[model samples]
Target: MKNNIGNQSDYDERQIAARGQAFQLAYFALLGALLLYACSEGLFGRWCDAGAAAGLCACPSVTVFAVTCIWRDAYRRPNERPAGMIALMGFLAVVNLALGIVRICEGDVVQEGILTFFICNTAVGVMAAVILAAYLLRLLVLRKEREEE
Candidate 1:
């Protein structure tokens, strides 16, 4: 019990927990937005793609599960969480970040004459990217702590 929470330069559980809580809140909020979008505009626009909706629903749910595992201090245990799930979440986070960059730079997020809020996919993507990144970093720190232990 001699201050084994990892190096002082690195973050402790409180920091990780705070970040996880933020991610959980953001994902839940995103879930709500997705629900509204699916109900109102239909997944992938007004075409009402049930297949897409079902597939997309898994993102938030799985992310929540992965983030919760990190939040609950499961990194130290052997059978607490699947490595594949964590890896999948990491891949998604990196992809989301890249896609957000592409959308903002190459994609014509601005319309012909006006900028609108509802059409701002790039912004939302970037926000989600940030959240996902924090989760990944927190996981990395925890894993490192486990290694040190």
Candidate 2:
């Protein structure tokens, strides 16, 4: 009976560890995808009409990348993520939230020209906000559950 109980405990620990690892992997994957999207838009371009629009579109992607990378690093190696990273993520999250609100507020401008452009960008920002929030929530829940064990 003692051996069986010990084996079961060992199995449970392994399962928890695996879960933690899987969460980190998923966080990194999300960060990578967001970074790819940011790069495709040429982030450092001159601020012209198209460039400004592209920059706006890229904001959420950058935010997603920043947050997810911080989260992944923090999860994989607890207490290893630098304070700067946490600060950066917090800053980016606030900026993105403001930008998303601005986009929604200005949505009426879509009727003027290139309706698809406005629609697509707005949709992207909204989706990014939703996804980022969901990811953060999942991370918090997982972390809490891990701690309780």
Best by TM-score: 1
Report clash pairs, candidate 2.
none
Model 1 regions lying over 4 Å from their true place: 1-34, 42-45, 79-135, 139-149
Model 1, range 1-149, lDDT digits (tens) per residue? 78565765554666566656757765785688577756766444453244444434544555455456456654334334545655764565566556656655764434443333322343334434544565667778877999999
Clashing pairs in 1: none
- Clashes, model 1: 0
Estimate the lDDT of model 2. 0.50
Error of 1 at 115 (Å): 22
Q: How far is candidate 1 from the true structure (C-alpha RMSD, Å)?
A: 10.3
Give a tens-digit lDDT track for model 2, residues 1-149.
35543442233544456555655655666566556545754775422245345554455555454345434433233333334534544565566556656765877324433332344444454545554565567567777989999
For model 2, what is the error of residue 132's alpha carbon versus the real structure, in angstroms, after optimal superposition?
3.8
